[model samples]
Target: MRTVEEHQAVVTGLLAPLPVEDVPLAAAAGRVVATDLPALVSLPGFANSAMDGYAARHAEVGTASEAAPVRLPVGADIPAGRTDVPPLLPGTVHRIMTGAPLPEGADVVVPVERTDGATDVVTITGAPDVGTHLRHAGEDIRAGDLALPAGTALGAAQLGLAAAVGYASVPVRRRPRVLVLSTGSELVEPGRPLQPGQIYESNSVLLAAAVADAGGDARTLHFVPDDVDQFLTTVRAELAGADLLVTSGGVSAGAYEVVKDAFRGLGTVEFAKVAMQPGGPQGAGTVDGVPVVTLPGNPVSSFVSFEVFVRPALRRALGHTSPDRLRTTARLTTALRSPAGRRQFLRGRFDGEVVTQVGGPGSHLVAHLARANCLVVVPEDVTELPAGAEVVVVLIEGALQ
Candidate 1:
């Protein structure tokens, strides 16, 4: 039997960083930046107004107040996006709107609310200090400055920043393509009425979603029959275009274990029992030069195996700086037991300070897994823990109930 860390290393070592490609900013969201992106233009580009007001020299409008109002002629109206802004005259103000470029020789802005709201000649009721309501060029970021560093995950704000820095497309690592297959002759598709001893297939759906959530492009080939020759043929046909092959079921020491039987003949994939609960039966290797990771058939086992092994590997392949889930410690709300010499990952709901077990340590508890936000990790040497014992927890994003 292999330790969890040993198996994880074997699985993770199979994949390398994917090749980089340039994708449009619209399609770059959730992708990792391949290289440092520098700003093409300074943020703001030029001096502009931060508010709708009259732009003038502070010396002219500094003393204007409601008690002693000052009257000035408005030279030109400047709205946002007006490129050819006229200069402010010696004794005149420009009616500038928010985000409009500041006219040459203008140093201050008197808000429209503090003015008489006139076009030709406006009465100023208050005076703002020099540089008020002005956005200087390069205030946010200077031209040629680093806008986003390598390995940065692109999100809405990151994409917006890239666009603001004049990047229509960004270099990012290509998403790994995973071909998912679930085997078993007794499995039937959902929405189809089940005959005796036949169950609806769910591992393909579960594994495919998990692959996508880990930044991989997943394609599921559902319900391959339990014949070793047929399974091998089916997998080989679709193996050409996939970076990885992820399959669930038929790997255990059972009579009808087609995946184990077929892959053992190839002499590439290695099947082993990982020293971990819910997902002890694990296998990792390659099939015809493509990486393969075989997970157990149980719903929770498949999910946990993907989380513990495949998710991090897929993210690392996609160029993510942090490939693993967020881990922290929380006190257990109740006592828990684990089999000695086997690491246990129990589904739990963590409320920042404390974690409560969602259900018993059963691999088939899919509903319990659905209600869990974290995995309460019990080490291989640990047999039991008292209530209030601090335990390690791995937070699964979007898994909260």
Candidate 2:
């Protein structure tokens, strides 16, 4: 049997990063930048007023005070967005609004609070330092400077930065297209009447949603029966557009294992049992040059396997800098026992420092898996652990209500 890390390495080695493409800024969120984006124009492209004030020569108001006020005639009203206004005349103050372009030859700005409210003649009672209340050109970012570096995942702030730098579209890594399939003759679609021995098909929906949550484009084909020829035909038909394929079921050592039988001697495909509970039977390979990953049939097992393997591969293909789930340590709220050889990933709820098991370690307990916000990990050799024992926890859900 392969160790968990060995299987993980094998899964990751099956595919390379997807190609990059240029996409509109509207669709760039969650996509990683392909190259460094430089600023096309400086922020605050021109010098402007930082406040509503009077533009004047600093030397004229140097000695102005409340006891001895200096009165000057307002030459012009400089409102925002007015570009035809002339430069400030010496010894005269201009009434300037916030964000208005600073008039040339103006050495200082005196706020309205320090002047009497007059349109024609204003009484200046205070003096300000030179260049006060002025926003200089390129104060936020300079033109031709690096606005966003390569590998940056465009979030709200990153998108805003790109827009500020005048980017309508950005070069980014393409989102991976994943084909998710669930195979079994005993599976029926949900909401339909099931026969005596059939159950509802759910792994496709579960795995597809998981792929989308990891920022990949996912499409699920209808469930295939336990026929190797039909499964291979369907796979080949859909393999043209998919970067990776994920199949659930038909991998265990059963007589009707269509997935195992179809690719048994492909030379590129390998099926093995990993040293992990709930998801021991795993498969990885390439079919017709497209990466294929086969997961176990149980709902919980498929979900856990996706979290352990497929999610990382999709994230890496999307160029994520940190591809693994957030991990931390939490104390066990109760004593628990695990098997001797397989590393256990028990569904759990972590309340900051203490983690409580949600259900028994059964691979088919989908309801328990739904209620879990974390996976409490126990090493292979640990058969039993007492209450309050610290265990490594992978935070599956960041915020749990």
Candidate 3:
């Protein structure tokens, strides 16, 4: 039996970044960059006004104050969008609107609150430091600078940053295609009639959503019956265009183990009764030249294994630079024990300072997963842990709600 770290290493080692594609900037959120995005042009493309005010030379308004103001003839009325205006002449002020391009030879800007409102003759009553209330050219971003690093997962801020640097489209990674299969004869799809010995085939839906959440293009195939040749036929046909294949329920030890039976001759399925509870029955290897992984049937077991193994792999394959789950140590609020030979993962709610179990440790407790934010990691070779002992936990979710 492999240790938790051993299996985790196996999973992480199989991940590599996917290929890149040029996509529009509007649709680049949550996508990864396959190439460096360098700034082509400067932000604030040209010198512009930061406020709705008069653009003037500070020397023209020498000692301009409320008691004795300096008045100059308005040379040019520059609104926000006008680009054909001439430069501000000496001894004159330009009535510049917010975001208006700064006229040449303008060294200062005075807001309307400090000046009398007039389109022809502008009176300045306040004193401002030179170069104040003005946005210089390339002040925010410069040309030929590193806009974003490679392998960056582009978010709203990143897309906006790239757009600010004049990028209409970005080079991003394409989302990986996935086929999620749920195999079981005792399963039925949701919103359908369930006869005796049948439950909703939710694993496929759950895993498919999880795959999409991890940045993959996933399609679910549920309720594949426990038939060998028929299942093999489906696997052969449906595995097209998928970067990775995932299946549930047929990998575990049982009489109707379709995945375990069907993939015996085609590929190497090294079964591992891992040194971990709930998700112990795990298998991973190539299936006819493609990487396929099998997770246990139970919802909690499958979800836990996905967090512990598959999600990181998919994130990596989708171009996540650092694809590992965050782990932290916290004081336990409840006493718990684990089997001597298998590491146990307990669902729990974790504050930054402490962790408390959501419910008792059980492989089938699906409800506890809703209220928990992380899994309290209990390793093998330990039987009991008293309350208040510090234990390591994998942060499945952050900032518990």
Candidate 4:
């Protein structure tokens, strides 16, 4: 059996990133930028006030103090968003509001509170330093400077910056569309009574959420029946323009593994019982030229498969620079054991740098997987871990516990 790393590479190699397209700034959030952005105009595009104050000349207010106040007429009042305003009159101050463009010939703005305002005759009891509270044009960003770089993951701040640079829309990679499938004869949908030897097929919903979390636009298709011909027909018929296909169950070692049976003769497949517990027997191949990632039948296995393999592929397709999940080494709060030959991924909750096992390592434990925020990683060589032992963990959802 191949190691987890080998199988991961095989899946990633088969799934390539999609092309880029133009999207509005609001819609660009969470999407990767496809083009470099240049500042159409300077950041402070014009000389504006950084604070609500009086714009004045340093020379006029040089000796303004409590004992000898320099009284000047309020020549012009500039409010925020005022683009065109006359320059300040000689020997006078400009009453400027915060974010307002500074009137010409005004070197500094003394906050209104700092001055004694009485009618038009304002006494500047405090002398502001040279250029105090003045925001110079292009100081924050120069015209023609690199505004936003390519491959940037657009967020609220990036969206604001892009709009400030006159880009109503940005070039961003389109989010890949994914179709998720779940297979098995012993599986039933939620809200139904479970018969003997039957359970709800939950990994479809869970994996779909994971795909959405990984930045892919995902949809869960109807469960594929366990019959080989039925499964193949449903897969072929429902596989529209999906950039990727994710399947759970029917790929394991059970006798009636319909997914494996249906795709057995089809070429372009890599079957690997990887060296990882909770998610070991898996497959990755192309069906009808669309990339398909087959995860193990178990719930924890499906979640781990998405984290270890599918997430990177989805991120890459969306043009993200860092396409893999983050790995953190943490101290285990409790002891655990792993299979002698397989690398174990224990469901865990991480607080700060400490990872406490959420439960023991079992592939079919869905409730434990649901409560876990992280996966404690155990190397294939080591079989046991004592309490407080350090282990590497992969964060899948939510903040560290």
Give the top-scoring candidate (lDDT). Answer: 1
Highest TM-score against the true fold, candidate: 1
lDDT of 1: 0.94
Q: For model 1, how many clashes? A: 0
Q: Which parts of model 2 are misplaced by more than 4 Å?
A: 52-72, 105-133, 397-400
User: What is residue 363's positional error in candidate 3, in angstroms?
Assistant: 2.0
Q: What's the TM-score of each model vs. the native?
A: 0.96, 0.88, 0.92, 0.95
Clashes of each: 0, 0, 0, 2
lDDT by candidate, in order shown? 0.94, 0.90, 0.83, 0.83
Model 4, residue 319: displacement in angstroms?
Answer: 0.8
Residue-level lDDT of model 2, residues 91-144, one tens digit each, is 799999999989998878899999996899999999788889999999999999
Residue 304 shift from truth in candidate 2, angstroms: 1.6
lDDT: which is higher, 2 or 3?
Answer: 2
The digit string of per-residue lDDT tens for model 3 on 53-136 reads 899988888589999999999998999989797988888899999999999999888988889879999888985899888888
Error of 2 at 313 (Å): 1.2
**CA shift at 286, candidate 3, in angstroms?**
1.5
Q: Candidate 3 versus the native: TM-score?
A: 0.92
- TM-score rank order: 1, 4, 3, 2
Which whole-number lDDT from 0 to 100 does residue 290 have in model 4? 86
Worst 10 residues of 4 by lDDT: 392-401
